[model samples]
Target chain A: MSSFSTAKPLKKKFTERLKKDFKNHWQMYLLALPVIAYFFIFNYAPMFGIVMAFEKFQIKKGIFGSRFVGFENFHRFFISPFFWRLLRNTLLISIYGLLFSFPLPIIFALCLNEVRNRKFKKVVQTVSYLPYFISVVVVVSILFDFGKANGLITNIATFFGWDGGAVISSAKWFRTLYIGSNLWQHLGYNSIIFISALAAVDPTLYEAARIDGANRWQQTLHVTLPGIASTIIVLLILRLGQIMGVGYEKIILMYGPSTYETGDVIASYVYRTGILDADYSYSTAVNLFNSLVNMVVLFTANFISRKVNETSIW
Target chain B: MMKRSAGEKVFAVFNTIFLLLLCVVFFLPVWHVAMGSISDPLKVAASSGLYLKPLGKPTLGGYRLIMQNSTILRAYGNTLIYVVSSTLFGLVLTILAAYVMSTRGLLFGKTFALFVVFTMIFNGGLVPTFLVVNKLGLIDTRWALIIPGAVSAYNIIIMRTSFSEIPGEMLDAARIDGADEFKILTSIILPVSKAIIAVIVLFYAVQHWNAWFNAAIYLQKSRNLYPLQLTLREIVLQATENSIIADADGQDVMIFRPLIKYATIMISIIPMMIVYPFVQKYFVTGVMIGSVKG
Candidate 1:
């Protein structure tokens, strides 16, 4: 049997690999069957519907039977005044998030890690997490009060002699309010993972750094930061992948027609013109564009991560 | 090797004060909501600043007003039903699926694992999902809320990973004792998997609790079945419209707005926050379980 199979390289390799997979791990296959079937049915199979982006999709004709329209759907969206604005807003918000909001949590976790008072640390951690559980609707409602012209935030701004009226509604302040609230909502939640990663660092590394006469700052820079470096890179890469995928519901809840120029993003636009207006074909086209950009960003990020740090999702 | 210096002590104290202040700011809205719910409605509407204390002699009026609305009560009922049913259904199916996927002896485990993970990375976006849900004839029904979102992809992955951490010897012994896969899963696999199960339940419950968008989109006509979030959202819409109307001063001040808004915020969040501290240890661990490796 070996001699016969060795004469045919492709067949030999296929059968050999297949035999190894089955003989020793047949129980694993049984365990994996339903989940495998689920992803196929639910996730991968839906990729076929991306074709509807090129089609004049109709419920009666279905995704396959619908007539293809070339790039008409994309053309409709790109020429519309909202396209450039949405793209600009999405990238700008994501960039702001990457620059400011992302680091606060890391710094917070580091600070929390350094606190010697365990009881005080626990209390701080508990309070930090409370804001994360508050619903987006509730968060926006509070932002409304803060951003209003006569709101307490406005009142505070007035005390400082800075204009704070209608911060949420104005084109100028929408990004700040959005990103600021985002930081508040996620800072505690985001720090938890970093803290866990911090826990995994070998205490010996800290000891070794200490023997070098390192101060807390020096030790953090030389040891603690480097120890959790991979976790940070992986997280940063994941965040980069989501540049186009900002949380849409919050935007939808907060922004109406008056605020769309500054606050409207890819997801909200899709939700509005696509889902709300029942413009499935055009919406699907726009969404397909979003998915494509997300894929590119994710792959580029993964590639950079693999090259720089040798850590990647793949 | 030196200890934290006096300069560092001052910085630490400042940092502590800053974080505490931020925490207070973070929690003020929640506090306002709780206070507004119990405070005199007129007093709450008229007041400004942080609302640090109960404004006056507490009244049951706001709760009374919210409760008097039968739709709110019905929506609450639907939400509770959805939360309980979905958590139970999701937990059972997830455990079964996780057990199946975690078997080292299973022939197709990695392929299946890859399949589950693929869904997490890439999705059909919303259109195809909506189409599938619609095709299932679940539109505008209570079942739309429960059945369509029965299994969370992330939760399933976590459960599968959790189940894999269980020892191989236990399962081998169960099989040798003539206990079938189903029996082994229930009696042996599940007993050791309590923490993961609790975490997934928390996740699914939160998802169900905050699920206004699905109910908003699906049950557009059925006000009777609208969840509290959607009802609260409708108030947001109404609040916008109401602000357009003039008061006796001929000024649109968004009157009586902050009261129920704060009250709704309290209603939606306070329950979850109260429940959180209890399951917090497991929750902290589970949240990392979702993000770190994910």
Candidate 2:
């Protein structure tokens, strides 16, 4: 009874403190007003509209006025033939990326750390990051040029008496082209995080390894790799979180009707069926499904990271 | 000096060659396109090997065609307007939000941060966002391009991380001098946080400059308001169709289409390439500190 009575004063005191702080920092509140308004209107407003996924949406009826049809849209999506195709393509491309592009950055950072020439290292870094800044349209254009009959790559292949048709048009080559270009564009930029992790490794550990008669390879294995293991794991978990998400913009720009079998992912499917066709309820249902899968995978990865390594992004 | 081991020597040589080769491979494709742009159109079309240089007499015909194209000019203007307005608006919101979140005595700062970060992990996705924009009557307007993507949660988080690093004593000193929160943010905090500001501004600028998806979706009905990337997309589509596949027709059209496409790509990317080196030094520090801490 005494503790319960004391809680009233504590609650009153907390409110009084909050009031004082607000009064003192009214200008801060004013500064934050526009930002708060932006998020509410732009971010939160759409979140509220996610309810449209369950609705039979009509433009005149609006989001709230539309009739709710629980699970019907999801049921429709689940039964659709495109579902398996999009799911397969999205997963395959993401897995291909995970297998290939994920390790290249780590290896690049490790290789860069071993280089003695500072200027040479800087040049390589600069040139490699150049493609990351290029627009998706331009990257696709460059890829098209390379894949074209008389383009550089095609011409080089033809020199070896190989068929030099447009590589992008072939369904079989879509995964290779997409993943290869991604590696080219992002390898250096992604390596920055790992490079920083490498830089943060203790010099004393390297000296100790040298004293122990460990060669460069042994030092890298025992000392350098261990030093960046947590960072690698952290980044790996983050990458796994994005396993369902692919660069739909590049795919949309590059894919033709011929290659749609391999190139169409959930996002591009959403764009086609939702935005292009204006199937609001159906697309929302599809996108909601994508986001849920992403969130579940993300949490699972985080859970595993926390359990195994005691490090996870919360 | 102690003689280096043969194993170390071989490894060093192998590593150098590998890095240099990787650098060349990364650089050569873009370089090839740039050279193709300036090469004589006829020679460019006829060449079978990799384009190492301008194939024959160099001409500015491709560039001249681009300059004379009114659609390209209009797209350039549209892109510039979008980049400037969006960057300014975003930077202001980001800095102000970060400052408030970083404030020492701010009530409910954690709540506000959770509100922001929640959007990063789970959004309403593309359809709902489009519907919201449509209902707001921003659909086909310039605001459609600028308003929706104006404030990114990642940029806000990164900016907040930088702001929190500011010394508490400095803000305390300003408070002691009776300066208002707004005054301190503008006069004191911003001046000290130039590096982060530059980084965030560049982030916003690059985003706006490269954005065509929103334009493709929101302003699909409006061609006059299409950004540079969208215009480039149309140009390339026509060029590819005309040059690569439609070969039985006009030979002269084929000659210049590849050049036109390459020149357009160059023109679109040249501005970013110029600014990239100057800002490259800031990127490592800015990105590392911003992301790794978060």
Candidate 3:
């Protein structure tokens, strides 16, 4: 239709729209220039370099010039004895973290919500959130100090006639110490979201429950929990998505040779092999495997949550 | 609002006890560390149990030792520089990106937003990121810490959300008066966006302070450039093994280990602790906006 009669007019209209659009928003583009370039170089560039996992990385040869080893690095990672140990430890630690460390904040928030005393509630919330800001190094050091044979917590245990000797270094105690400290650190801070959701609950629902002669527990069960259910499910799905990606800094700080049985995670392993030991290609392959699994699990969780509960981050 | 029943009163009593215990559990460690850092080194070593108060008269020996240590001093300076420079640089990038994206008529906001969000879930792992930094010749340089994490995509999205909440009429009024994008941002947007700015700066500063892994990797050969956390970690690692060995018989090692370790921990965290209460309110709101809005 535009071949002869309307082609000229349509072309004119398109160019005019393009010119007007650019004229109006050139300043926005100018502002976005540095951000685009920064992301391009820092984020996208490293993404392209993920290929080094399949290649022999050499300093002199750089990424492209290096010889492609085709699955050799991945092969070594898969066949190595450390592979299964690493995988087992990573999975166990993640699962332990998911099991024990996940429900804490919700419970804390729910409990805090039930408190009738305003001043006491504020104090509890403020005091509880303080630990969240302490650095991982300091957090672990506190653990180490308290877990020493004659340290505070150990002494407390001894006072109660229980053995707490060298708990930090014991393999069996590693998961407990790690998850417990994690619970101590993040429980209050993470509860802020649920607390905010609680604060947003409709007042009419509570009044309605009260008019129906519902007790506090019944009201909480009927009105409060359902009010924040979507928030709970969304947060749960988000947490589940990253079950494989525990923060490695605290683990690295806390774990020792003796406790590696329970403590070594994928990130720390990657740090050891890739950065410390300089096995770049092999570690890259290992990390890529972890990341791919995380990506798949994350999307699967999101999909299932969306389909079942109609709640998701997206 | 109604009168409390017996069952409700029982539940409230139990809840109060539980929350009080929870509060003490969270607060006791920090209190103990703070108290122990100032306690006599010999007393700390010999006590072998909790001290509700300083034992054998508090001494400044531990802090004095940390202050005199050149490594700790240098790391302190390095951390300060990293925190300030990184916060400023990151804020600029974040604000610029967020403002542009929040603009009503940006050509491809959705495409750009997707580009940023995709990096959140998928990325090059450790080796590839290290390789990129190595290729850029940022290894062993201060720029390594400042450049790699300069603009957080999540923070940008949060700031964008904040900026978009600024009414369109405000921006349009400025534009009609012949202000350019930069002028409009400085005069109209910046003046009203203080809350988000303060929150982002605090967040970035805390992140820079807490970060050591990046510095450990990028500044592998440069001990002098190591941040405070990295230096503190080294001390803790060495002291851990030494203390375990010393627990067998060596009194001298035991005397100094906890003192030095606790002193270092307190020194590292003191800044954040000092500023936390003043900025505490913003943190809750900031986190809520980021999480709920996202």
Candidate 4:
């Protein structure tokens, strides 16, 4: 009874302080209202709808009134023939993308750094970012026009012994087209960060290396690489975190039934089933699974990066 | 200047040549499309290589035909409306969020910031988001394009970083003269934030200008509301030439179909090409600002 009497005054004091704070900064709270409401309606509300994943969803019944089905939706996905194919396609496309699209930018930046003519370098850099600004729909359109049976890219491929009828619709060529287009689109834009990082490297380090009789090649290896190493590592860690997030927009634009074998990924599959086919419960369950896996991968990458290099996004 | 060895001289020549060739490769596709758009349509359809020049007498026939298509014109107008409205809407919300987040000693500021940043890492995926939008009756409306994606947390964070860099003394000086939070934000913060604001505006404008997926899914029944990029998709990807060239009779349709695709692409991209060069430096500045916190 004595403890309860003491707790009442403490609780009252806390509320009094909170009320005082609110009075002092009521304008700030007012400024935050729309932003908070926007997130609540768009982001948080959808998160709440993730509950539909466990339900046998019906459009008429809606999310709350839907019957509970436990893990049956998940079971259906796992047992489906598409499960393994989707997983493989997603990993392969991401891994291939990482392998080519990652290092090429760094190399391009390094090469640009060596150019003596500032005007030439500026022009090249400007032109390089142009493709990045092009829409995916147009980029895919370019692919279609250039990858047709008698088109420019196809003719070039035939000279190199490609027996495929058309590059765009071929399952074997889907990953290549996707990753290559990404490289074309992003190589210059992605290198912007590295270019800035290179600029920040101390000029005195290069002077010292030259004073020590180091050649340009030797200087780059000894001085420049070490300067940008942290930026590289941080970007690599960020990249690893998004390894499962090959977006569906470009894939949907590029792929057809013919290329789904090599092109169908988790997000694209979710989009097809959920939006196109209206398989709400099953699609949501599959997507929930994908999200969980992505979160796990991101956390694991961040943890390992922190332990190893003392650098993490958080 | 340092004396160059033979190998160094060779490398210099090779590097310059390589970068020049790379520039050519980068510019070729757009050049190809532009050249193809004006080329004789019959000659283009029969050809099978990269277009070095417009073949068989260059003409503006493609442009004339495309201009006659009401769908393309209406779509262009729709895209402009979306870009301007969304950019203005997004910028105001971003400034508000950035101001609140950058405020020092505000209670729950960190909590509010974390709430925004958490959205960047995890989202509820497509179905739930679609369901929410559907439930709101935004399925076939203009609000579907503008409202749901109006505020990006990434933009908020970038703008917040830029805001936090402003001298707190200026804000404090305004407060001492009986200025409220809104007064300080408008009179002090925003005027000094023109560069970052330009960057954010460009980001939002370009995003809305190029967007089609939302329209593709949301505006299924409302073809009249379709943006330029979505119409471009139907013409280029689905090869639905009939939708755009509905007025053209038989022979004219066959001749102008391929040309119309090229012209539409050129039309959609011209605004970006013209505007980007002027704003390019601002984009670089934005990237630099984003990297400062990242």
Candidate 5:
């Protein structure tokens, strides 16, 4: 450290500058009060409550009064028969969703962007967004009704030389149906951001490519792909962050005992164990596990994107 | 253009055909529900591919049954109340927070901003959130649904971006003219940010209207207090199928499954389709705020 006699002038100058800045901006603190309070109360405050997950949380005794349970809640959940099956099913469903729903909106947007018939494009966009507005309960009920072995879809499948026999009940078809329905629901609405990203590409680049004798497909691959590459990467990373958080509402309503063999996911298991069974501590442990895995995936994804593609959600 | 030989033409034709077919597949469930709802139970059961052009006179019986269900009316009322109250309250808070964050040199504004972003990455999970809500006496009440979800981090981000784009000189001029912060917010800030505000309201409205998960968790009172979605869900799942079966009088009514599903879907989606177009312009204007802020 510099001697006080030598450093005194510099220290005084720094303090004086900081003081002036604070005095000039005092009103800013007043304006920031409500927002700071909101996040503190609603968000940061809840963080302390995460401790309950690790305890024998008793509502009557309170978190402070509850006994220190160590890892018992987690151990209980992991030892349950449903643990591995729920995880496998969750992974499979998410994989199917990734395969189906992920590419759909991007492809749809690309196709729609390419369409010369604007009316047809508009109609497609409208119908696609329409399904997103329909509640998951409605979507599931409708699916269930149409899923009965002799229901409309099943009967029609018979004419097409296929068995739609109890599709919802069959463990094999659960992921396909769920993923297929999801693709239908979100394809158009999710395409909006991709389309916007595509819009930002300079038309002059395309014109230059055309002048260079690049064909439609060639131009698309060379120009359009690079232009939307960052958008795709960022969105992909975001999607990875949500990998474990499957569509809980629709899954619960559509799935039953018959379909549980293939259809049960971590979220649904947590719901049944945590909410319906009222095993709060166990569900919290399982949910916390899912979140930890999700956080890892999110950061790894963000890091990899940053390294390989220079695109990240962070 | 890819200079197409005959093979390329065939491929292009195949691609278009495939897309069209996929579109039909996507639309089939909707058609199935609509057709099934109107056809007589006997006829619907006896046929396959129950088309929109009915084989016989389309019956209004299913709709009449829904209309007769008193719970549906009550739920509809509850949904409207929740939607209006939540949208107004959530929007007000989001705008205020966004405005405050947008203000120049807000002391520790950047740190305060990071706190908002912090929520996106972490949470206490459901049990703790439920405990917090319960501790606050919000559980079992409408306040649980509204207040807990009031400040969407996404909404605040976009609204903040919109507010920040307002020139500082304009706000200073308003201040010099003796306009308070609230007055400036209403007269100047809000007027300029109307487009983004509309998008957030639309997003929040749809979200609140579609939400029943929170209600399922929180509300312990009368089923009569159920929102339209929750009530209609119970009726559709618990009643319509079984009630129809019980009344079938040995007649096969299973075929009516797809029919009534369509009617329910059509009715449920009608509100959104009707309301959405009226606000299309504003929604399209600046929804890109979140992704592409300069």
Candidate 6:
């Protein structure tokens, strides 16, 4: 009885403190209430719905009433012919994108940093970012026009001894078109980070390099590169984290049946089977697998980056 | 100043010329579209190469036709509605979240921050999110576009970083003058944070302006509710031009189809191209602010 009395007083004191805090910050909580509710309904609720991956997931039966199938959906997906194709396409597109898109921005920034004329540099930078603001739908439309048979790009290719027709619909050209367009659209916008990082590089470092008889090329190699090395490393780590997250929006807009051989990715596959085909349980399983892979890759990248360079996103 | 070596001079000249060429390459696609949009429709259809200029006699017939198309007009209106409402809604929620986060020594502040940041790393995939939206009866409704994507955790973090930079003394001064959190936020915090506000507004506005996937998935049954980009997708990508080319005869359809495609592309992108140069610096500022550890 004595122990119970002491515990009751302590609990009462904790409640009193919470009440006082609430009273003081009721308005703040009131402001946060809607934001909290928004995330709950949209984000957290769906996380709970991930359970659908394990169930039959009939629309009529609903998530809870659906029959549980344990890893059957995953097993089916693993054995499906599309398993290897989707995996290969996703990895190849991401790797090719990383190869071309990633370093180009840093190189673009470095080149821009070397310009002596400010107005010309600003104009080039501004014009370059224009495509980044253009809608992906429009970008694809432009691609369709340019990649059609007898179109400008096709004509150019023909002049260079190429006879392939309709580049947009060609499976062989899918990754090239996708990655090339991505480079055109994002090169400037992505380089903005490195550009700012370059701006932050100390001028005295360049001066010191010059004093040490280092020319502009040597200065760029020694002072300029190392100055933005951390930014580059950090951005690289972040980019590595998103290796599995090549977005479905552009892919869906760009891909047709003819090019799906090379164009279809995991996210687009999920959209096709889940939303369009209504294969809810199976698609959810595939998506869950993708998300798990993404998280694992992100953590592994962050871990390796931290170990090697002492720079991590977290 | 020291005289430049021959090698350095050559490098500088080459660098300038290369950047100039890049500018030309970047600007040419838009130029092609614009030129094609104004060209004679039949000429545009027959032509297969880049339109350096209007192929034949320049005409405003394509623009006139596009203006008369009810579907394009309605979709444009819908896009305007989506962009305005989504931006306003997102800005309010972001400001509220950012203000709360920037508050020093607030109870459960760290927990609240982590709650927001956790969504960035992990999210419910497409199927589950769609199911949730469906369960809420938001499918085929405007709310699906506005509500589901209203508060990006990224924008909140950016705004929070900007808000945290505001001098705390100003806030404390207002507090001492019997101002509440809301009042301080409006009177002191907001008045001084216009640059960040412009940045966030631009970010949200452009996002909504360019967005079509949410509309595609949500407004599948409601063609009337389709935004410009979705309509653009149907016409340009899906090649479903019946809605836009309804009254035209067979011959005119062939002629005007390519023109209409180019014209529509130009119309949709013109607003962005026009607004971008003015707001370019703000976006650059936003990027720099985002780069700061938050």
lDDT of 1 by residue, A7-89 (tens): 78967777887898776555545654655554555566566677778989998999878998999999999998888999999
Which digits, one per residue and each the tens of the lDDT, describe model 5 over residues A244-277?
A: 8785788887888888999999988878877787
DockQ of 2: 0.67
| Model 2: pairs clashing at backbone N, Cα or C within 3 Å | none
Q: Model 6 shows how many backbone clashes?
A: 0
By TM-score, the best candidate is 4
DockQ of 5: 0.43
Q: Can you give the lDDT of residue B223 in candidate 3? A: 84
Chain A, model 2: TM = 0.95
Candidate lDDT scores, in order, read 0.77, 0.85, 0.84, 0.90, 0.75, 0.89
State which candidate, 3 or 5, has the greater DockQ: 3
lDDT of 4 by residue, B93-183 (tens): 9999999999987777889999998888888889999999999999999989988888999899899999999999998998989999999
Kept native contacts, as fractions per model, are 0.43, 0.72, 0.74, 0.66, 0.38, 0.77
Q: Write the per-residue lDDT of candidate 3 for residues B118-189, one digit (tens) a residue.
A: 778788888888888888899999999998987898898889889999999988998999999999989899
lDDT at B224, model 4: 90
Considering only the true interface residues, what is the Cα RMSD of candidate 1 after superposition? 2.7
Off by over 4 Å in 2: A1-7, A155-164, B1-3, B47-49, B238-255
Q: Which stretches in model 3 have alpha-carbon errors above 4 Å?
A: A1-17, A153-165, B240-258
Model 3 score (lDDT): 0.84
- What is the C-alpha DockQ of each candidate? 0.45, 0.67, 0.67, 0.77, 0.43, 0.78
Weakest 10 consecutive residues of candidate 2 chain A by summed lDDT:
A149-158
How accurate locally is residue B212 in candidate 5, as Cα lDDT from 0 to 100? 84
Q: Write the per-residue lDDT of candidate 4 for residues A1-314, one digit (tens) a residue.
A: 55987999988988988898798789998999999999988999989888999999998899889999999999999999999999999999999999999999999999999998899889999998888788888888988889989888888888999998888889998999899988998898899999999999999999999999999999889999999988998888889877888898999999999999999999899999999999999999999998888788888988998999897877
Worst 10 residues of 3 chain A by lDDT: A155-164
Q: What are the RMSD figures for all models against the true structure?
A: 4.2, 3.0, 3.7, 2.2, 4.0, 2.6
